[model samples]
Target: MSVSSHLLFFFSSLGAFNGLLLALFLLLKKDKQYTDNWLAILLILLSVRIGKSVAFYFTPTLDKSILQLGLTACLLIGPCILAYVAQSTLNNLTMKRLTITLSCFTIATVITGILFPYQDYLALWQYWIYRGSSYLWLISLVVASVMYARKNTYKLALSKQLLTQQPVVVLAGSWLIWTAYFTASYTSYIMGALSFSLVLYLTLLLALKSKWQEKASTTQSKYQNNKLSTEQTTRFSNLLNNLIETEQVYLDPQLTLPRLAKRMSATHTQLSQLLNDHYQMNFKQFINTQRITKAKESLKTYPEMPVEEVAERCGFSASSTFYSTFKQQTGMTPNQYRTTEI
Candidate 1:
């Protein structure tokens, strides 16, 4: 075999091998949603690359038969992998609709290609349409993946970054390979380079997975540091409820940590520590939450009371603090909430 052919064989095999490993890892460790979906996508793309390599080896020329078959597979594989990734990452129905649309498009492309094989001009036109449509769909998938990653509630900061970055990298790499293959002459050198790049890309995905695991570990540690033991949490909750029920703490205009701690029969240091360590919030936020709860009740039951009256009745020192705290907790200002009720 020539040098280029040998390189193609090696890279093609490497791509296939890495893809198989990714697929197996995902299948075995299906507990992680992000890793599983990403691995599945890698597998699909690698499979398509493998098919393309084999097709090129068999067909010496890029004619109607080769173009038809290769383009059809490309169209099918790109969208299928994207849809699966989106579904797995977002866990939503949008992925399902995208998958269904891609599937229908793939079927139509295949039917048209098969039916018009002898009509070379028509076949080429159908091929370009399918390719253009698939490219647009791929771009949409990239955008959706980005939006999902940005808005996802995944607690690990690094995991979110990795999720956001990896998809764009993959899309860029795929575009480069597709552009090189279609715009330039078909050579084993170009094909091999693409295959090798894909292999490297897949290896980077493994790094991403490792980063995700590390982020998960950090998140668990943070959770442990912030969380209170069940017994302590329950005791704190009971004490908080009792303080609010008595209305003594609420009536104190200068309600401070030392005063509240004394009323609860706890030292200032102990109460401050409990509020900070257990609730992951400062004493002010904890107190504001209670005040907001009371204000909400007053708003519903006594609509005739002015907002300022409600704030003062709820133990808030100022209307500005009351409005800010209420909005932060309920995602609406006092006036907006009252309007909603009516």
Candidate 2:
């Protein structure tokens, strides 16, 4: 092997190793919800895919077998990411059907690959179909994530749940790493896999730090009040009510969980727990409900008010966003709701 190939093998191996570690950590992590499991599986599959790159550059003997394995890994990447995003944002039971459908697609593709396991076919399949699908699925998920974030009253809430960076930001970073890897690997550029490894390592570090922060926050909360007393809970609830009903704080377009918590004189965790335990909604959902209620009144009271202006008055960031959110919440557009109700 040349110097460049040696470098590729070493760095790509490093990335695969880091990814494996991250996957194990996430898999064994207790108390994880749906997104965590999906992310772990994504990491594992990605690790194997990178491992195939290492083999291609370094191990000419085991080329065909590992190529097939890598392509199989590639097949799962899209479906797994789509499932992860759906669970993370929508959190709906219907996503189970989506998962099943994706699984069927992956199985069918794998069966086809097995049936046509020749170098010519495999090369075409991997280069044209699977590689493109991997990037395309990730892009779709990224766009969905961006839309999900923008549609919410608090742009960062969903991101906080998924990644340390905003979902788009993280996905953007992932895309850059992927783009570099794709261009470099296809051309046999020595440094192509290097960027992917380093980015994966950085992501692992960020995820770990985020996890630690969560743990520390939970511990501190447990130590501080050791669970809210009945009186304290009532007081906090009342404060939240005053903030929402009296102050109408949800009218702010930039309303966020941390900001609202500050206004309530409560910790972010405490406020989050309050909503989760009591209202059974996250901050965005709770805030949107309030906004939708107020929007309905405006639409009814002033039928002449433009739908765009109504959305702005209701704290939506964009007119399009407002329409979508309003429709989502009430099952009717603002115009329809106005006509029907008035």
Scored by TM-score, the top model is: 2
Give the poorly placed runs of model 2, Cα more than 4 Å off: 1-8, 60-62, 120-123, 150-153, 156-170, 185-192, 211-342
Clashes of each: 0, 0
Compose the digit string of candidate 2's lDDT tens values, residues 80-120.
76676565444233466787887788788777777877465
What C-alpha RMSD separates each model from the true structure? 13.6, 8.6
The parts of candidate 1 lying over 4 Å away from their true place are: 24-29, 32-42, 54-68, 81-93, 117-122, 125-134, 141-169, 182-277, 280-342
lDDT of 1 at 105: 80
How close is every model to the real structure, measured as TM-score? 0.48, 0.61
List the lowest-lDDT window of 10 residues for candidate 2: 153-162
